[model samples]
Structure formats: structure tokens, C-alpha cells
Target: MRHTDDKELIRLLRLSDYAAFEELHHRYWLKLHKLAYRKIGDRQDTYDLVQELFIEIWEKRGTLNFGEELPGWLQKRLWFKLSGFFRKRGFNGKHQENFRQYLENQGFDKCFDPAELREVNACYEDLLAAINKTIEEMPNRMREVFILHRRQQHTVDEISDKLNLSPKTVRNQLDRAIARLRRSTEAYDATALEILFIVWLIF
Candidate 1:
């Protein structure tokens, strides 16, 4: 079983062979766990995600077409799971703390005056909208690299591996993406620009 290839394992899996399923899980669990932990940054959540991924694979064994690249197929599913996790935990705890600290450093008091708070909220919303538009307008590969690296917190090497590109190419894409975003935000005021920087950093 240890030496068996993925296609055979998958074929047995579709027939509900427990040993084949266990073998597949053994082969991929560590790699999947590491990737999940890197993207999620939570030990328990990473464990749960990896567990759920195996469960899903087992459940969908009959229908999933893994082709000749089982590793890639598993990784693509993990990426989708990670995306769903982030969406469900939108503006997560760390992000909220970062935002709060940014406001404090900019001299906003704990008890924000209602009107001032409203104005700040509006400005933040506008900045987000503009930044999203700019990202949307970027070239397809560049946008994917940027989102994976910055928004999804993936490292350059991770992005390179996932996208099947060289590390240098991934870095180049990120650099160009950042430069384009800066140009798009140039019309913003100093405070708005600062806010945009914070948003990029925390995300």
C-alpha cells in the first residue's frame, strides 16, 4: 500500500476500500496540514481543516476526478477550504485589532465622536472600494499572485509552488501589483493613504 500509486489508491477508494483510503490519508496528511497551518495560522483550525479535507475526499471519492496528479487535486480542494474559512471569519480578530491600533496611532481617542467616527468609516469604505476596483482591473495572473500573497497571507515560496511559477516570478508579480495599487491610491489624502497602507499590511 505504501508503494502503490495514487490512481490505484483512488480506484480502491471509490470502491470504499478502507485500507486504500487510509494509505492516501497517510501520504498527504502532513503536507496538507502544513499548508493549512501556514494559510490559517491557527493550530486547531488547521487540524480541523485537514481533517475535514480528508473527510470530504472520502465522501466524494466516487465522483472526484483526480487525474494523474492527486497532490495537485488535493491542494486545490484545500485552497477552496481555506478561502471559505477566511470568508466565514471575515475581518477576523487580528484584523480588527490592527484596525483599532491604526486609529489609535492616528490620534483617534477611545470614545470616538459620532460625527468624526462616521466620517472615518465613510473614508475607509471608500478606500476599500477603490482598492478593490484597482485589484479587479489588474491582469489575471498578477491579481491571483497578489491576492494569494497579500490577502491570503501566503509566502512567496508557497505562491510559487501553488501557481507552478518560479519564486522570482511570484515576487515580480507582487512588486508590480503593489506599485499599481499605490498609483491607483495616489488621489487619496495623506490620512486615506495611511489607511490604505494599513489595510494592505493587515490583510
Candidate 2:
């Protein structure tokens, strides 16, 4: 099983082969953990995120589909996990500064001079302002629901009960609110759009 190819391991996984699953876990655990740690900057959170990724993989193994590259697929799933983690925490000034430091530590200074870094930070702030403005422009009820769910860290069920709405309605409001914010990004240029994507990931 240790020498089995990814495709073969995946095949065995779908059939509920424990050895193959263990082998796959052993193969990627360190690499995934390192990636998660770099992005999250917390040992415990990184461990939890990577563990959750593998658990999800196993739970959905029966429906799993890998294209040409299994590693890429796993990494993509991890990226989504990271995005969700940041979203649940609610991005604020501290996280923005941490991300900037992360970039600098990754040698972004070699790619972007001090002036360019300042410009990127400015664009990032501007995009955030635009998103907040869009959120504020949402319908009254929608804005309330979004604030409760996102800013106040309330779950859909909690928001529904507080607002006297169905959970489905709360979810719909959130979906529409997110869609409106996405549309607002279209007005930005490429650089701003790139910053918007990063904001989306952490927001």
C-alpha cells in the first residue's frame, strides 16, 4: 500500500480499504500540515484544519473524483478549509496586518518594492471599503441578517429565531447579500480585483 499510486489508493479508498486510506494519510499529512501552518500561523488550528480535510475526504470518498492530479485536488480542498476558517473568525485589522507580515516574510519585498507594498496595502483597504459599502447598501432585513450572521458570529438558526424568519430565509438572505458584494467587485481593476480575491478569502 505504501508504494501504491494515488489513483490506486483512491480506488481502494472508494471500496473502504483502511490500509490504502492510512497510506494516503501518511503520504500527505506532513505536506498538508506545513501548508496549513504557514497560512494559519497557529499550530493547533493548523492541525485541526488538516485533520478536518482528511476527515472530509474520507467521508466523501465514495463520491470522490480526481482529475490528472490528486495533490492539486487536496490542496484546493485545503484552500477552501482555510477560507472558511478565516470567514468564521471574521477578518479585521489584525488579520490584515498578519497577512501583510506573512507576505513580507515570504519575500514579497523581493518581488514588490516598499512603494509597491504600500500601494498594494492601499488597494486592499480600498477594496475592503467598497465591500463594506456594498454591505451597507443591502436591503434593511438582508443587512441585518448579514451583520448578525457574519459580524456578530451568529449561526443561521440563531439569526432565524432572533429575526422571526425561517432558516432557509436567513440562508437566502446571506446568499443574495454575498452575490451583491461579488457584483460590486466588477468595478475594480485587475490589481484591485486581486486584492478583492484575497479579501474574499479572509473575509
Candidate 3:
């Protein structure tokens, strides 16, 4: 598809046209997957993230700001998604005063600089690796419950039915999974919190 076709496709997308969604997905899937891969370094995660990104864009098309370049706009949204992933993973704050002071020292224009971007990516990669490692080491039952609830997007009720466990048991398993993750990454909490703060500053 030509660059000009993006606008027409987006227009159609706003009207919930299936063809438009399919064409846009065809046009950008590879690039979006590559973008997600560069940050995540996991093939499955990259594919899932990209798919989620497109689903979100398609769902919100009526209110989307396509801007001049669709890819540019998409990248910004992907960054936000990545940031949210970290935030949800329990990056504990390092004293409110320290966080505020750190934010005060940073400026907006540098968010896009090569060095700053590298630092941001490094922080993100580190946190992601740590989280994945922790999850990998989870107890079998907890891991299964965590994966079903978080990665597979299954509801607790659904997981309980699938696993033949009580709903409270499923919820308890998920809570334990999160607690274990937080404990596993406590050493990096300060750095991850600072990194997440920078992300909030940027977008």
C-alpha cells in the first residue's frame, strides 16, 4: 500500500470496515512486530504485543489521531503499552521525594536523544528480562494461573473452570505469583521505578 492509502484506510477503519482493518494490519504488522521485538527481544511477546497494538488502534479508530505518519503514531502507542507492562509488574517506588527530585532534573527534549533512548531501552530490557525470569521460576500451579490470567487474558472465573480450581484458589494463585515477582525483582525496584517515571514524563 502507498503512503497516501493510510489515510483512506484509517477513514474506513473509523467506520469499522473489516477490509480497512485487514489492509492496515497487512501494511504495518511486520514493522510493528519488529518494533516490539527490538524492545522485548522475545518473538512470541513481540507478536502478541503487535497484535494487541493493532486491536487497540482498530477499536479506538474513531478517536485516533493518525497524524501525518501512521507508523510514527503507532510507535508512540507501542511505547505507552510497553511502559504499562512495566508499571503493572510491580516496580516499587524509591521514596516519593527521590522520585520527584529525579523527575525535576529531566527535560522533555532529551527523551528522544540517542543516549537517553538507549538508557530507556536498556532499563526496559533489564526489567523485562527480570520479570520473565521470575515468572519462569514460579511454582507450576502458580505459573499456570499467572499465564492464564495475565498473558492469555483469561478471567479468574474462566481460569478456575479450566483448571478445575475454586475461584478463590485461582485468585490466591495469581496474588502469590505477583508477590513472588515483586520479591524476585526487589533489587532492581529503584532503577525500574526511575525508568518508569521517565516513561511517564515522555508520553
Model 3, position 22, has a per-residue lDDT of: 87
TM-scores for every predicted model: 0.51, 0.53, 0.45
Q: TM-score of predicted model 2?
A: 0.53
Q: Which residues of candidate 2, in runs, are more than 4 Å off?
A: 92-97, 102-203
* Local error of candidate 3 at residue 170 (angstroms): 56
Model 1 lDDT, residue 162, Cα? 98
Task: After superposing candidate 1 on the true structure, give the runs of residues whose Cα lies further than 4 Å from its correct spot.
Answer: 94-203
**1-203, model 1: which lDDT tens digit per residue?**
99998888988999999999999999999998987665456788889989998998889888988867898678767756654564465445543454455445434536442122222322444455566677779999999998786667687899999999999999899889878877777776534434444343334
Error of 1 at 12 (Å): 1.1
Q: Per-prediction RMSD in angstroms?
A: 10.3, 16.7, 14.9
Collision pairs in model 1: none
Q: Per-model C-alpha lDDT, please?
A: 0.69, 0.69, 0.64
lDDT of 1 at 104: 54
lDDT of 1: 0.69
- What lDDT is reached at residue 54 by model 3? 86
Clashing pairs in 3: none
